[model samples]
Target: MTQETEAVAEEAFPQPGPQARTGRPPRRGRALAVLGLLGELLITLGLVLGLFVTYSLWWTDVLADRSAAAASDQLRDSWAAGGPAALPSGSPSGPAAQGDPNAPNAPGAPVPGGGPTSGAGGTGTALAAGTGVGFLHVPAMGRNYQVLIRMGTDADTLAEGVAGVYEQPYRAAMPWDASGNFALAAHRDGHGAKFHDLDALHKGDPIVVETRDKWYVYRVDSTLPETTKFDTGIVAPVPKGSGYTEPGRYITLTTCTPVYTSRYRMAVWGSLVRVDDMDAKRTPPAELRRG
Candidate 1:
């Protein structure tokens, strides 16, 4: 009876297949597994976001600082090798000398050929795109604050901590030029934050541009703390709303504002106060000297 009964029971159940014994995993176990997989995915996502933050905030600053320093050194060396003659001591007379009240020569001094002449030339020709044109010094920003001025204002051009001058619609007027707007742009944050402290500039602050042959001195006249990115009028020849009634020599510095964002732009305006020939020592004008 026992053997016959056992054989009948085994046939009915067949000891159950391995899958049936495992029974498609317990519902609780499946739920736990799913949660484990999701946790792993979240961990990986956190790592990626952390890396991105490090790259944007830290590595970018380091790379941009290095690039800017190299460009600044190269420009200084070029100026040292071949620069303009020292300003002659005396008064310069004539219409050419009228604009620059701070020229080395006195207001009524005898002038030769006109006013001061740049050894580089008086035409103030535009440099090739992306090439360095000069060095910009803003004493109000910092004592060591200076950046190479380049030809284009594109992102790549400004990423190297260089300011680019606008050349379209109206060409940038060199300091030697009789009159026109010299518009420049740089990044306000990241890329070394070249113009990060632009807000620090106050009226009467000096914005000095050093060319191969001369130093153009501009005094801050006004500032537009915030403006839309598309507002090209800020760089206009007459610079609408800039407090200028007539055409004249002007300098405009533009940068993104609000910090770490490109939503708007800030501008600092100045008018050319004087042009000084590069001295033998290539010394900066007294206006640019820090106390």
Candidate 2:
């Protein structure tokens, strides 16, 4: 070949160096894999910590004393306006809430499990049951939020900071007061929000539901993580001896678990253990005043 022709060929097709010819391919692939793994790990970490950061910003850190005081004041005012004057100077007995068990009955009562089932349909049963929710309070975890009581998965209560009460009118069946399961829903983020830390509850944790002049104490019996689509069977009245049941009025609490993900829900259940007439006595720890 002519010298000129040889030079032109060399320029057109440059040879690869030692590293590029053999070692570079595998090393490059490994570097890319490491980067991919790091990216995934970072994404997961952000998801978990993002909720924590949000809660830190939104939660009020005044300790349980402040919460207790606030709750006391709210109860006093509510009672005075509703009837029976104030909650005494000290503490009172019975349910901090009061209802005649037979006060002519409202349109719909709270449903077992959570959210408004399809049973209510377009009949406004959802809205009616939604009203029965009244107020929600968790003393141990220090949370109190005004419940909105909406229906179905369409509405995300966490975004709204509202609670939901499921009621009848759907094809599905639940019991009435002292009969079937009464279910309610809220959120959990370690914030001063509704239902946060619900899953962290152990057996014997305190949960209180209030009406006007009655206070019913419900101790935590069990907590279940939502793996399936919340079986209607699980929400059955009395929990059906499934290890989460007890006598008297029972309450089933439900919420989304693992923070920001709806992939699963966490449920904490309690049965009405003690009933008190708040118009009677005054004491701390709630149990001090009996019926």
Candidate 3:
């Protein structure tokens, strides 16, 4: 009713004290600080997790592949100089050639004395295949998967789509460079990240493979979608029609289709365009051998 009374009322209601701001005691600043801290912690954790995954895959692949290649190279050299007997029988140089880090230990094939000569007409045919790098890279998908020159499930350890190189009927199959179907299989989703993008690949896309000796570039020619049970008999030793013939060094890339589902498979077929030898200075070192 009086000027003094009105002034007192205004002070009493003046922007509720920090204590009664929310109808509860103050702690607004404390609560805000806690929330901010939690958010920062979460962000830091995410970054660490992402780095761990990337580095783990990268380094493991680098070591496993390097070891396998070194061993294979030794075996090949021994065979070239003399024969399997010349290979190591006990130590690192010994029978170790047969075993794989990701595969069960087994006897490896004795080296072939007389191998395919360079340019043997077979896409991949080559005597004493130069063993340098063993991996494939798909730039489009940021993929880098190990390649198995040996046979069996060795390659499947990191990726199950394809068996070890040794497991494949190598001698029976034409040289990768030879004029015939040169098929490679990799997991749809697994380690090595092989053919994971097999289904997503479009016509004319590039498929690049690097062996210690050279880099093979292939261009996708077709994309075939078949049911999970659709025989896939084409991968058999004697491939049926499957739109491929026994000539011209065709590169067949196969992976489970539908991205993350095994209900079916997508086969992306390609033909070898050019084989570039890294050491020959035809292509840059980075492009030839992925880091």
Q: Which candidate number maximizes TM-score? A: 1
The 0-to-1 C-alpha lDDT of every candidate, in the order given, reads: 0.74, 0.49, 0.49
Model 1 compared with the native: what TM-score?
0.74
Best by lDDT: 1
Cα deviation of 63, candidate 3, in Å = 12
Task: Name the regions of candidate 3 deviating beyond 4 angstroms.
Answer: 1-133, 143-150, 153-177, 236-242, 280-291
**Candidate 2 lDDT score relative to the true structure:** 0.49
lDDT of 1 by residue, 118-190 (tens): 2111223335677777889999999867888888787788887788877764566555555667789988777
Error of 2 at 271 (Å): 0.9
Position 153, candidate 3: lDDT: 32
Please give each candidate's TM-score: 0.74, 0.51, 0.47
